[model samples]
Target: MSTELTSREVCQHLRDAALGVRPLQVIGTGTGQVSVDIEGWRLQLEFDGKHLHHCGHCCCPDGREWALDSRQRFGTDPVSLLSTWELAQIEGLLRRAE
Candidate 1:
């Protein structure tokens, strides 16, 4: 497998990490949330019918959160939003994860 991951692939990696040995959980019909711990930082992302929201708690100022709409922010492209968010928050930690 390649070290670099697309946004969708990164999301999958997070899902795998979060679900390790735990009872499978679904956020909604199609929406889901995933949080992964890398080093001392926790990265989190959530997607729903309309938007994809992400937070980099460690890197944010005063623990503030950020969210982006799939349509307005990424032109209805989820990969763009997620990938961009991942890079912004953890500086490519998701791609580096196993």
Candidate 2:
């Protein structure tokens, strides 16, 4: 079963998994993109009001390697395509990185 989550929920999870004590920093308030930094690794999420644009990237520890990140987005509503478990898994990555 698929469960869609709200934008607030997504942001909350990201904030909770942030590396430092402070909350996740909002990068582009006018561009529909938000990102968090953890030990030089930046995790970004973008939404086009209806779809979660999974065109984010991450900087590898090597500092010279960059990888395209992936997140599932397959529904209507504002960034509501990701399921609960899927979101958790994403958050887990951040936690592990920290």
Prediction RMSDs, each to the true structure? 12.1, 11.2
The digit string of per-residue lDDT tens for model 1 on 1-98 reads 44322344334434443434222222223235545443322345443323445532221223333333344444332234344444343323332331
Check candidate 1 and list the clashing pairs: none
Q: Residues 1-98, candidate 2, lDDT per residue (tens digit)?
A: 32433344444444444333444443443366556554444546654444445524443244532334245344422124456654555445434433
lDDT of 1: 0.37
Structural similarity to truth (TM-score) of each candidate? 0.25, 0.35
lDDT of each: 0.37, 0.43
Worst 10 residues of 2 by lDDT: 72-81
CA error at residue 12 for candidate 2, angstroms: 16
Error of 1 at 19 (Å): 22
Task: lDDT for model 2, please.
Answer: 0.43
